[model samples]
Structure formats: structure tokens, C-alpha cells
Target chain A: MDKEYQIQGTRMKFWMPKEVDHHKAAALRDQLDRLIEMHQIRELILDFSETEFMDSSGIGVIIGRTKTIGFYGGKVEAVNLSAQVKKICCASGLHRLINIREVAENDG
Target chain B: MTDKKTNHMHLYFDARSVNEGFARMVVSAFLTEMNPTLEELSDVKTAVSEAVTNAIVHGYSTEAQQVELICDRNEDELTVTVSDRGVGIADIPAAMQPFYTTKPEQERTGMGFAFMEAFMDEVRVESVPGEGTRVTMKKCIGRENGR
Candidate 1:
């Protein structure tokens, strides 16, 4: 809850926790969904540098938000996925739904 | 209660959504002595999360129930059992089938068991309708696999 989620113009960036389970997914979705709707955000960037574990619940969070913003032709991008997290995302077929990219430390 | 031949831990926590992450962390930390690879660790953690989430969400439906996590590990393998005393599953095979969920309204992917099966060496589900459900999973973590 103390983690900061940033929004700039049409782009929004949020940092995930070390573990993205059902508990964390719900709160993250609620807050981000509200921001997406309020700001009419077209792009969402999920930063996963701090995340080491994620389940289908985490996948649900991404898909839920992707659908919310998709109404406005907005897309979701996930970055800094650890190899393990990337494998889970790919197994869940999240890569097909969202843009998966690697983010350098210097680049926000 | 732990046996001398195998190291084990038993956890009982309120079936609150907040404890899902905690359950996974406990299991992951227990497996750390085996020095599992990141991928293996992730696989186990994700599977545990799914099992715990199912217990809290679909099983109890947020009714403030109790969930149990029992972990046992020897030098060769690790086993985890997640149980809940909530509304039990009537048909487990159908439940395990991909894309099938009791709570489709919540947009559940219904891939919880699938991931558990894929990641662990073996997965077993035991449920008695109106009684509860138990999911037991085991994975090899011997020298060849863990190291």
C-alpha cells in the first residue's frame, strides 16, 4: 500500500510487489482501474522489477485492467519481468494479450 | 508435528485474501534449504498461491474460514498439501478441466490446477462435497534437480 504508482499524461506506471497473489492483485486492480478511467489513460506500463512470484491471480489483474483500458484502444505493457515471472506470464498466454518488453534501469 | 525422516511444517491461517502472499512466502522459504532454481522456486510459489487463493476465494467465498498448509520434504522430494473446510467441490475432474471455474463472474481463468499439474511432478485433489477439498502436490528436489 505504501508503494507509489505514477501517472503522467496518457501513460501510467506502477511497481508490483515481490509476490503478486490474490490479495495484492485485488487492491492493485482497484486503484489502477480507477486511475485509468479517471485519466482516460491510453497506455499502461507495469513495472515488475521487484516482483519475483506471480500466479494466475496476477494474470487476472493484468487482463482485467487491459480490458478496462482496451475500451479506449489503450494497451498494457509489462516490463522488467524476471525469467520466472516471464515464464508464468507466457504460460498464462499474457504475452499474446499485452506487450512484453525489457526495460533498462536508466529508462523509466 | 514433524517426523525424523522428513522435515515438515504445518500452517493454519484465516482464509483472508491477504494471507495468500504469506502462504506462498512460507512455502518458498521452506524450500530454500534445497536451493531450488529461481524457475523451480517460482513454479512452486505460483502453484501454492493458486491453491491458497482457491481455498480463500472459491472455497470459502470470503466467508472467514480457516485454511491449512502442510509441507513435508525429505532429501529427495517436497510435498505440499492445502486444505480448506469450506463448500467442497462436487465434481473435481470438471473443475480441473482448463477454463472451467465456479466463479466465472469473477473472470477466473480456472488454470489453477493446470499450473499446479504443469509445475509439480504430481498433483492430487481430494474433495467431498459439503465437507471440504484438499490439494496435494509433490515435486522432486534431490541433488540432481535442486543443485
Candidate 2:
């Protein structure tokens, strides 16, 4: 809902909601790209604790963001992946480029 | 409610939560019905996340479009259909290649499909230029049919 995202050094956080469908991908990417441009972040830590679902379009976001971080010589880290989310991430071999973990939930 | 409609769920969301973390949650929930082993579930979740992310960033450019996720379960078999009406892929075969991507400036590994194939039993993709793309993936628990 917010256009601008806050970033500390290179780490940035964002949340994906349950209403995002085909129509919301553009705006989401715009926000993410804006955040990326503004922060020039090195390592992006994505917080996906609340998301309910994702599709092929969602995959594009990861690929696009990973590319963004890779351009900055940084990397993306996936955090708190649920089984559904992890299935796709693991299948895509995303771990080879980015690190994914369940640390946030462990702390909670 | 337990007759024939208990094994179906429809989810819709934006790219905001498709982050690597949220992707995890989505996958976890998807596997709950199957009661799969951790390793088996993990593999499925990762594959699903991969496809969803593609729809967000590449499919819709992760702007603000809606993502539709349909899950159907039959016994030990689960089928996930992730669809998006965003910028469709211009090249199907090229996109499926191991390391080919249009967003070179973005530093994409270009292996989204590769990973999907490695994790899920079957992956099917259908796209219409200027329309959208839909990816269908299926896997069965405890069968070890095909990966």
C-alpha cells in the first residue's frame, strides 16, 4: 500500500499480502524496483511470513529482484518460507544464488 | 463439507508477500493436507515458490497485479496452478533454457524452470503473448513417481 520502502544500509524488508493477484503485480514490482533504486541495497531480506499464495508472476519477481541484487554485487535472502513457498523456491534452485531460512519464525 | 469439496483451495495475492520468506509460508500451507515428509514437502514448496515468483517479477513485473493460485488435492496427489495476466513470455523455449533471460541488467540466474523441473513431478506451461501465462505443476506424496 505504501509507495516508499525504508531500507537500512543494504537490507530491506517488504510484505506480500493475500489480495495480490494478476492485477497487482505491476504495482508491486514498481514498489520493489523503487525500493531497490532508492536503497541500492546489497542484501535484500524478503519477509514472506504473511503471504498466502504465489503464481508464475511471483516467480518473475524473485528472478527480477535477484537480478537487481546481483547487479549491485549483492544477493537476496529468502526468510520464513512456508512449505508451499519453499517447494517452489527449492525447486527453482534459488538457494544457489540466495540464502533462505526460517529464522524469523524460530525467534517468534 | 467433507465429501468432494474438501480438497480444494483458491488463493489470491500480490507480489508483496511472494518474497523468499512468504514463499515459504505458501508452500508450507500447501503441504499441510498431504502430511508429507519434511524433505518431500520442502521440495514441493520450493518449486511452487519458484513459479509464483516468476509470475510476480517477470510476468507482471511485480507491479501490483493480482496472482491466482489454485490448489487441488486428490489422495496423495497435489496439483497447483499458478496463473497471471501480465506481460506474457515472448519466447517459450528460450525462456525455458537454463541460463537465458531478457533481464540481463537484473542478474537473473535464468534457471527458474530448471529448478521447477527438478522438484515437481510434472510441470506444464501455457502462455499467450500479450495475454498472460499459466503454469501447472503436480506431485504425489509417497509415490516417488517422477521428479
Candidate 3:
């Protein structure tokens, strides 16, 4: 079984699936919740390099994680968002809360 | 409604979350023949996913039920209707309000309908309590031809 996330120091990077919707949101949320509980995570990096499709459910997951980590003054950063995901995020006002970063070709 | 041609399709599937990807794939595939721009395609996919998720989460409350997707394409416009025969919304206006979610504890941002409105050219919602809810959204694709 492939782990859905990886923890590195104070930053936990989550590799989301290609499709993010209501069906997969719950499981993803649970996994993230458990990880947050076990680790002293201060930065949640949502790596969207592998994600092609994201809907409101994806937004829900990000918001939920943001609130959860906000308790510890943790911040969430979204990286490598495709144009489609970026449009949705802009419309949902997510850019106001999270730092949206661009990924370079060599930046794995 | 464009003047070139018209195509229609209907799909019925379980309200499981797994099918959300299925719904997006099917709709995108169906629209491929129209040669929609990437943005146009993504807009439709996002709108469809939001409507379908609402039906699965709010309409059926994640229980075992059925969600139906009906799509109509005419010229450069694609119309999609996602419906579910589950608990209907009592106050649709309230439901459409930004940041008004019934399941906030579940991390629902109450932005489902908002996303639909933002992505699609037109969005219309209708529901009857204890019966079902239907979300109809339309978008003009093929932006290359200046649609």
C-alpha cells in the first residue's frame, strides 16, 4: 500500500491523487488528521503535482487541515496547482488563506 | 444552444464517493468531440463534480442511493444536470449562500454551490424536500472559435 503522505522535519507533504472529490475526501481527511495528531507538524504542504482534478471536496480537505493545524500556528501551502485547480481555488477564495507556490521543473 | 449539432447522454450510478471521478471522466470524455479548450473542459468538470458531490453528501447524506447525470450538448454549449433522490434542501436560497454548510463539522465549506455558479455559464437548482434535488449547469465550450 502506498502511503498518501510523507513527513519531513516540520513540514508534511501530501501527494494528492489525480481526482479529488467527495468520495476520496473522507479518507484523505482521516489520513491527514491522524498524521497531524502524531507529529508536531507546523507546515502542511499540499503537493498538487500529481493532482489534475480538484473540486469543492478538495477545498474542504484543505480548509479542514488548515483549521486543524491553525491551532498550533501551522500554515498550509499549496504547490504545483494546475490551471484548473488554480481557477477553482481563486474562485473559492482559498488564495487568501494559503500560500500558493509555483513549482519549477527541477524542483521535485 | 448553439446551431451546429446536439448530443445527449444520461448516466446513473451509486452515490459512492468513488464514482465522483467516474462522473468527471465520463463528462470530459463526452465533451471531447466538441474540442473544448482546457479551461472550458475544466470548468464543466468542476461544476459537474460539485453538483454530484452535493447529491452524494447532502442529498443522500453519504448513504446508499443513486445519483443521475444528464448531459446535453448543442453547438458549443454543454448542459449537465446532476440529480439525486434523497433528502432535499429545505431552503435552497440559504443553501446557495456562501459559506453556509449544514455539515460544517465534516469540513464542508458550504462552497459547493458557489463553485458550480463560478465554473458554469448558468446554474439552476430545484429541489423538493423528502424527494430529490436537481442541479442544472450549462457552459459554452470551444473557445477557440470565439464562443
Candidate 4:
């Protein structure tokens, strides 16, 4: 509930917290799944602008959402990933599943 | 190779998801003595987080248990060991394989061992069925060449 959510028509955007681990991932999975079902969201954008640390659990959250939304012909895209988060994403082969925006020098 | 121990700490906490961050904080704070670079710090934190998570989720599996975390620093090298006395893994090799989680329903990508191995210079796992699992990882900090 502390996480922020934005909805614009069928697209939904979620702002991740400062840390994305198993504890947060479980909560995120529940909330995002509910939103996706209720709003019939076709496009999901996970904004990691504030995330400083993320482990495999973060990977699970993204993968879970990808599968959930993908079934409805929806897509998941990640934006503003920090270098540390990006490393985990790439290392887990998550880059191949969803569209991940490159991190800008100014973006955290 | 001066392996003289510089510092060491041990932590025992309930195997719960909430303590994951606590474990990371303790390890990172302990490593500050070496003045580790941001990258090195983040790598070890991620590796530690993964190990602790596995102990909570897979090892205990909704049962209340204890997770033991041990950290030691020898010169530029830091070693971390996370152990749990819960349901043990029967096959270590299969469990370490990427994307081979036993609990996919919970969205476990089975990448816990992979992340530990990826971020650390060395990773070793020891387990006995019906006993427990211990994951020990070592990383050399302040190295000119990156891992």
C-alpha cells in the first residue's frame, strides 16, 4: 500500500520502493495482480526510479507480472533501473522477457 | 596471502521475510571498515539477501525457525555464511541450477544460488536431507579488477 500507482486508461504504472526483496516482492505480486485484473490493464510499466537494492525476489515479481499480463496480450516494461538493479535483471535473463530502459547518468 | 582475521560477527534471527533487510544492513555496515566501493558493497548485499531469503522461504517454509548468519573479514576478503535448520535440499546441484525452483507457484525463479554465485568470488553449499543447508560465499573487496 505504501507503493505508488498510476493509471492512465488501460496502462498502469507502478513506482517501486527503495528496496525490492522477497518481502516487498510478495506484497507487490498481490497488489499488481489485483490491479491488473480490476483495471484490465494492457500495458504495465514498473518504474524503479527509487529502488536502490533488488535481489532475485525482484526478478520474481517482474517475471510473475510478465506472465500474468502477457496472458492477456499485455506487456510489461521496466524504466529507470539503477546499475545495481540492472545487473540483477540482466544476470537473471530478465532483459529477454521484458523491455528494460537503459539507465541514464542522472537517474538513480 | 595474509588471511589473518580482522573482524567477525554472528547473527541469529527468526527465518522470516522481514529480517532480510536487517541481515543486509548488518553485513554492509560490517564491510564499511574496508571502505568498499559502492559496486562491491551492492554486490555483497545482493548476494547476502539472496542467501537469507532462501533460508526463510525454502528452508523454513512457513514454519518458524532460526537462520544463522556469520560474517568474517580477512584483509580484503569477506566471507558470509547463512545456515538454516529446516527442510533440507535433497539435491544440491539441481537446486543450484538457474530457474529450477521447487516452488514456482510463489514466483520463486530458482535463482537464489545463481545470484550468490554470480556476485561472490566463490560459493559453496552443504546440506543433508532432513537436516539443513549452509551457504557460504566469499568475495575479495578493494580489488583493482572487478568481479
Candidate 5:
């Protein structure tokens, strides 16, 4: 499986795809979980710079991963969210579950 | 005042997860003539995606089936309906409730109906216990500021 994530020490930053519907969310879920386990990820950062669309399935992917890593007090942060994605994150009550950063600090 | 043209389309495809994006694209493409705003297009696409995903994930549930998508535009109002002849819902009210999902293991957030209702002007669901489910949603374009 092609890795869609980057790992540095205990942190993993995942690059979200352009469209995050059920089909893509499923694949992302599996890959993200596997990467989290393999790398023992503690801090997960979802980079939404490329995401233009997202539905409830994408919300499920985020919540599922949050629960997985939350068991060990791991944190999940989302960055560079677009207007459409921000609305979804708030509407699904995901804004409270994870930290959403409007701009990436390092600009990588 | 020139009369606005009315248009309609019917789409039938396999109830597979892969077609979810195709359904959204078709609906957006169909609405291009209306000159929808960016937010308007995004809202419709999101709602359509939710409805189609529900049919494939909940209605069919691993069984290969057919999903039907119909869209009609009369004036500025757009109507979209997605239907499936697979296993239907036992209680639509319970199903529409936020955070109520039968496939928790699959990580379903159960917010499908909610998103449709939120983004669209109106949403209606019809289902027969053992028959199937049809979701119809309506939205009025170019009226965001007026509303």
C-alpha cells in the first residue's frame, strides 16, 4: 500500500485526498489505522490542504481514528481546512473532538 | 422576462461505493446550467453524496444492487431523488436520528440524513420495511442571500 502519511518520531501527518466520500474514506481509514499501528503514532495531524469535498463518511474516518489513538491519550489535529470542510467539521460536532488549525505553522 | 428552461435527468448505476463520486458529479454537472454559486454547488454535492452513500452502505450492505438517481430543475428549484431496491429501513425516524447507526463497526457516524436536511431546503424519506428506501431533497438556487 502506498503510504499517504508522513511520520516523524511519534507524530504522523496524513495528507487528505481531494474528495473524501465513502469510497475514499474506507481506503483512508484502513491505511491510516495500519500506519498508526505500525509507527506507534501518538499525535495524528490530518492535513486538509487538498480536500475540496467531504461527507459524513469522512467524519466517521476522523472519529474512528480519534477513538483508536485516544485510548493512549494520543491527540489528533486537523490543519488548513477549507470553508466547505470547516462547515462539515463543525456540523458533525467534530470541531470539539479535535483541534482545527486554520493555517499550518511551519508551512511545509 | 424570458422563461427559465426546465430540465431533468435519470441515472441508474450499480450500488457500489465507487459510484458515490460519480453521482455527485452528475448532479453538479446537471445543475451547471443554473449558474449555482460555489456554496450552492458544494451543498448539493454534499447532500447527494450522503444520500447515495447511505443506499450503498446501508441499503445494499455488501449485496450487489442497483441505485437510481433522478434530478429535476424547474425554475430555480432543484429536486434530487436517490432510490434503491435493497433491504429497507425498519424505522426511518430512528435511522434519521443523529449518531444512530447500525454499522458502528464500520465507523458510520449516522449523520447522513442530518447532512442532507441541513444543506437542502427540504428532505423527505420513503421506505418499506423489506422493500427499499428513497430519499428526495429539494433546494432553491440563487436565493441564499434572500433567505
Candidate 6:
């Protein structure tokens, strides 16, 4: 399964499917770290286009990455949020922490 | 978020839906409208998942249980409730604190409540130890025009 991540330029993008609770959280974290290291990522834009949900562990992944990205003077952005998923991001204060732009944000 | 507000259909779910993200999206899609922003849907979905996950893992540790979801929509409010009859939390304040987790090895972020608090207009978590837990969240949809 190519659930790892894809890197290009300074943008380290990954797919976060919901159900990212404890069991898979560790794996997700490791995967993110490796990608950041591989491309020496300075900026990240996660595509949740395929993801349906997330949990505390998933939140941890983002927060931890925010810290990591901050150290490198990078930023994290999220695009393509379903209404329901957007609620969770707002509830988690992800909007404040990360740059949340819908697919249209990448447009004009 | 800058356009207008609209009401969403009331929703429900089971424990299985929360642990599995796709199951949750089934409900998320149910609420999407022509103008429904992705951020709006994501926030609600996350809060629902967090609540339901709490029901399954914390509320029903090993035994069979059910998670009940009810969504209510009015002119300006969208409320979601996730309830389960599992082991209840002994301390609410501590659990609400950032980074406080009952299971650390499980990689618990302990930010579930934090997220809910940030996303919803009102977030209340009530638990009766050995009984169950219920999370009620309310948000004002399409607050663009104060609708």
C-alpha cells in the first residue's frame, strides 16, 4: 500500500485517512518523519481528499509535525476538506495552526 | 465560510463508524450541500470521530457496545451528540487538559477535547464512571451573514 507519502520540491505531502487512532498513529508518524527527512521538507500541504476521519492520535501527528516544521521554518497546509471533516479541523484548532485552503485555494 | 449558512440533516452512527474513518464520511457526505465548505464538514467529522472513538475505546473497553449519534439542525445551530454506555471518566477537567491521556503507549494525542472545543460553538463532555460518556457539540453553520 502506497500509504506512505509523496515529496516534491520543498512540499512534503501525504494522505491522512481517518481511523488514524493509536494503532496506526505510530506508523503514520514514522512515515511523516521519513518524508520530511528525505526531501528535507520546508513546507507541507496534506491532501485529505481521500481521508474521511481523524482522532487524537491523528491530531498529535499534525501538532508534532507543526513543531518539526517550525524548527525548519516551514509551514503545513491542508486542502480539500469535506464539511464534516472541516468541523473537526476547526474544533482541533488546526485552522489556526495550519494554513487550511480548499482545493480552490490552489486554483486562482 | 464567507458565503452563507445552511442547515444539515440530523445524523447518527455506531462505534464501528468512528474507529473506521470511511464509515464516518458516510455521515459527512450526508451533510454536504452545494455550498458546504470542506472546512465545515471536516470540523464536524473530526468532532464526531473523536467522540465516537472515545465511546468505543474508553467507554466500551472489551465488551460489545453501541455508540449513538444524533444531529440536530435549526436556523443557526448544528448540534451533534455521540454517546455510549461504557466505562465513564473519573475526571473531566484533567481529561480536557492538553496532552493528558489514559493510555500513552497507544499514542493517544489527548487533544480530542481540545479539538472539539476549538471547532464547535459549545462542547460538553459528561461521563458517569462505570456508566458511559456523552459528547454534545453545537456549531453555527454559515455564520457569514449571521444566519
Report chain A TM-scores, every model: 0.89, 0.80, 0.90, 0.90, 0.92, 0.84
Q: What digit string (tens of lDDT, one per residue) describes model 4 on residues B57-103?
A: 98876657999999999878999999999889999999999999988
| TM-score to native of every candidate shown | 0.90, 0.57, 0.92, 0.93, 0.95, 0.63
Q: Report clashes for each candidate as comma-separated counts.
A: 0, 85, 1, 0, 0, 27
Which number leads on lDDT?
5
lDDT of 1 by residue, B1-147 (tens): 555546899999999987887898899899987778777787788889889999998777655689999999876589999999988999999999977887766768888998899888999999998889999999987544525
Task: Report the poorest 10 consecutive residues by lDDT, candidate 4 chain A.
Answer: A99-108
lDDT of 3 by residue, B1-147 (tens): 546688999999999877888899999999998998888888888888889888888888656789999999987788999999999989999999989999988888899888888888899999999999999898888766675
DockQ of 2: 0.15
| lDDT against the true structure, each candidate | 0.85, 0.70, 0.87, 0.90, 0.92, 0.71
lDDT of 5 by residue, B71-130 (tens): 999988999999998789989899999999999988999999999999999999999977
Q: What is the DockQ for all candidates, taken in turn?
A: 0.67, 0.15, 0.83, 0.88, 0.90, 0.35
Q: Point out where model 6 deviates above 4 Å.
A: A1-55, A62-108, B1-14, B17-23, B33-35
Please state the CAPRI-style docking class of candidate 5.
high
Worst 10 residues of 5 chain B by lDDT: B56-65
Residue range A1-108, candidate 3, lDDT tens digits? 854687878778888888888878888898888888888788888888888898888899998889888988989989889999998889999999899989622345
To one decimal place, how large is model 2's interface RMSD in Å?
7.1
Taking all chains together, the TM-score of candidate 6 against the true structure is 0.63
Residue-by-residue lDDT tens digits, candidate 2, A1-108: 642334667777666654333335567778888888887778677776776554444556777878878987987777766666665565556667688887633232
> Candidate 6 — number of clashing residue pairs?
27
By DockQ, the better pick of 2 and 3 is 3
Model 6 C-alpha lDDT per residue in residues A1-108, reported as the tens digit of each score: 755466668876677764566446678788888889878998887777877656666767887888899898999888887665566566667789988887724433
CAPRI docking class of candidate 6: acceptable
Task: Give me candidate 4's TM-score against the actual structure.
Answer: 0.93
Q: Write the per-residue lDDT of candidate 5 for residues A16-104, one digit (tens) a residue.
A: 99999899987899999889999999999999988999999999999999999999899999998988899899999999999999875
Model 4 residue B11 CA deviation in Å: 1.0
Residue A51 of model 5: what lDDT? Answer: 90
User: For model 5, what is the error of residue B35's alpha carbon versus the real structure, in angstroms, after optimal superposition?
Assistant: 1.1
